[model samples]
Target: MEKSWNNRAWFMVLPVLVLVAFSAVVPLMTVVNYSVQDTFGNNEFFWAGTEWFEELLASDRFWEAMGRNLVFSLVILAIEVPLGIFIALNMPRKGIGVSVCLVLMALPLLVPWNVVGTIWQVFGRVDIGLLGHTLEAIGIDYNYVSDPIDAWITVVLMDVWHWTSLVVLLCYAGLVSIPDAYYQAARIDGASRWAVFRYIQLPKMNRVLLIAVLLRFMDSFMIYTEPFVVTGGGPGNSTTFLSIDLVKMAVGQFDLGPAAAMSLVYFLIILLLSWVFYTVMTNRGVER
Candidate 1:
């Protein structure tokens, strides 16, 4: 028997399609137009071809920012993935403790980005801030404003604090979804704690770990607001990621052509890397 497919559902999706076209596609097209053309103040645009792209590709600033972004992403993934998994493993598996752990883990994720930045900014200050005052009392010179290393540390710590919970929540979800049969089998085998995690829990959590890694990578790479608010691209561009540099070019200097080119490159890099991550992780999941 042939089932009739409902063509009427197409109408339901048409509005969404139109909305996306207006919101995303049109803005993207405008960006593309600006990328390939030079603009003068009086609504005049000149055909510039790929000159801006070539310049951006050759610029040291672009490479420096890219390097910073890469380092930050790698460091974040290194710290967050393992930390999240460990936290997930230790979290209470049932009862009131589970509720308490879940709520605590969720609290940081609920804070707005700007507010997170402001909180950290105040928290890290040397005068009245608990962190700063404590550090100063302990004879540690901690100043994000004057020192590049301090700025980097603050930004990295802030990011970890803000986003690690997301990884924990995802990993926790994966952990909780595993069937009792796996644990029963492990118990019957006399599997040690490490053995249980290795042979049972790790494999079960692989898919969710992949998702957490990708989300964290993309978010860390594209991070702007919190870091910008906290450090303002900082003491000497030490923490200036690609998005920060792009905004500096576009808004700070009002250089549309180069900024557009940089933005396109940034978008392509993210898309390519995300595709690679998805492919590698999905394949590994299938193999497991």
Candidate 2:
């Protein structure tokens, strides 16, 4: 006998589809509309074809911001992924300390983005802030306000402090999910600590590691709030990522057409890069 499907579930999904249509699809369409058009004033829009896109593509400012974004994302991934895995490996596996460790690891992730930025902004102040005061006392020149390198370092450090927790939690979950049988087998084989991590834990955590890398990369690439709050994309646009540049174009300069075109291109770049990351990681997993 053939089984009947639950057609009522479609009714449950209708609300979600409608929500997405309004929230995502509608705004996307609006951006597309503006991207290919120019405006003078009073709701006047003129068909300009791909003029905005061409201009944005040819702009040096756009490429410079793109380069900054790529570098920041790479640096974030390099630091966070390995650091997270190491922290997870050291965490108490089975004890009362587990809950405490998890809570501590989650604390930073729970902070609001803007609040995190604000905290760092104040904390890094050289005159009154503890970090700044301490650094000054130690005879180190630490000012995120005027120095480009210092601004970059401050932004990168703030991001790591805020988001590394996410990677840690993900990796910890992956580590804990490995069954005791695997550990027991490894022990019976008299495997070294490095060997166990290499052959067993690493493979088990591959999926979660992939997730951590992708999420970190995307978040770092699109970082805006903290850096904006701290540096306002200043220090000569040293820490300005693509998101900050896009916002500066759209709101600061009111370049609607170019901003819209840039937004679409930004979305496509993210989508394409994410797809590449997923495909390469998944294929590697399959091969392994």
Candidate 3:
């Protein structure tokens, strides 16, 4: 006898679809509408075709921001992925210590983004902040507000502090999910520590590592608030990534046409790069 499927289950998903349509799809459509049009004052709009897109494509400023974004994302991924994995590896596997480690790892992730930025902003002040004061007392010139290199370092460090916990939590979850049988087998084989990590733990953690890398990449690329609050995209645009530049165009400069076009392009670049990362990592996972 053939079994009949219940179609009513789809009703449970309808609210989610509606919410997504309102929250994501509608705004996306609005951005697309603005991207191909121009407006003056008083809500007047004119068809501009691809004028803004052409200008953005030809602009050196756009390329420079894109380069900065790429570098930042790569640097963050490099640092956070390994660091998170290392921390996870060292974490207690059971008991009260497990809970302690998890809670500590989770604290930074729980802080609001703007608050993180504000905390760093105040914490890095040369005269008042502990970090800057210590550096100053040590005779090191450490003013992120005045130096481009210092500003970059501060922003990068701030991001790492804020988000590395996410990577750690993901990796830790992956590590814990691994069955004890794998460890027992490795022990029976007299597998070295490095060998066990390389052959067993690494493979098991691959899925979570992929997630960590992608999350770090996307967050770093689109980062605006923390860096904005800390560096204000400055020390002469050294830390001004694409999102900051886009905000400058859209809100600061009030150049809606170019900003809209740039926003659309920015969205596409993120989508394309994320797709590439996902596809490549999934294929590698499948191969292994």
Candidate 4:
């Protein structure tokens, strides 16, 4: 039986569509306009026709920054996903302890990104910072400012501390939503803890896990402020990920053409990788 379609629903969505066009589409158009053109001065633009794109693709500096971004994202996902799941598993499932644990997990996430960076920056200072001072007292060399490895470790650990709570919260929500009948059935069947987690909880949490992965991946890939503030893309470009390099090119060096080209490419890489991840994970979920 055919029913009348509610064409008026379009009216309800028009404001949101206009807002999206204003916020997203307009900036995207500006980027596209700049990507293929060269501006010298007086707002005069000359057509460069992929010149910037070619140079960016050929540049070793661009690729190195991209490699660093990829490595950071991979390391973050490796640590955060499992650690978040484990933490969620151990969290109190009910009562006042649940609220307390949840609040503590929420605290890190509530801190502003730049503030997190600043806190870590001070915390890792070699002179008076607790972490740095403690390490020095223990006879370990720890200086994020001087050592590339130390910078990497500090950034990675900072990210994990700040964002792992997000994954934990999401996984915990998934955990709590599971019906008690499933656990009762598992218990009746004498299912081991590992067996219950593997067969029931993990499968139930797959959707949320996928959500956590995509969010973490996109955030980590586009990370700029935290590392920028902490290391400022140094210890000599050791932690200069793609976003940092883009800012250096655009604002620091004032090279709009190459920066615009790099940004578009950056956007495309993120889109492609995220799509791949979603496809692989969703396919696995469907099969299971």
The TM-scores, one per candidate, come to 0.93, 0.91, 0.90, 0.91
Off by over 4 Å in 2: 1-17, 281-288
lDDT (Cα, 0-100) at 256 in candidate 4:
86
Q: After superposition, how far is residue 243 of candidate 3 from its true place, in Å?
A: 0.9
lDDT of 3 by residue, 24-56 (tens): 999888888888899987999999999999999
What is the overall TM-score of model 3 with all chains considered together? Answer: 0.90
Model 1 scores what on Cα lDDT?
0.92
Query: In model 2, what are the clashing residue pairs, if there are any?
Result: none
Name the runs in model 3 displaced over 4 angstroms: 1-21, 284-288
Candidate 2 has its poorest 10 consecutive residues by lDDT at 234-243
- What lDDT is obtained when candidate 4 is compared to the true structure? 0.94
Q: lDDT: which candidate is best?
A: 4
Residue-wise C-alpha lDDT for candidate 2, range 119-209, written one tens digit per residue: 9999999999889889999999999999999998998899989998998999999999999999999999999999999999998888989
**Candidate 4, 1-288: lDDT as tens digits:** 999899897899999999999999998888888899999868999999989999999999999998999899999999999999999999998899999999999999999999999999999888988898899999999999989999999999999999999999999999999999999999999999999999999987888999999999999999999999999999999999999999999999888888999989999998999899889987987898
Go through the candidates in order and give each one's C-alpha lDDT. Answer: 0.92, 0.92, 0.91, 0.94
- Using lDDT as the yardstick, the better of models 2 and 4 is 4
In model 1, where do residues sit more than 4 Å from their true spots? 1-14, 285-288
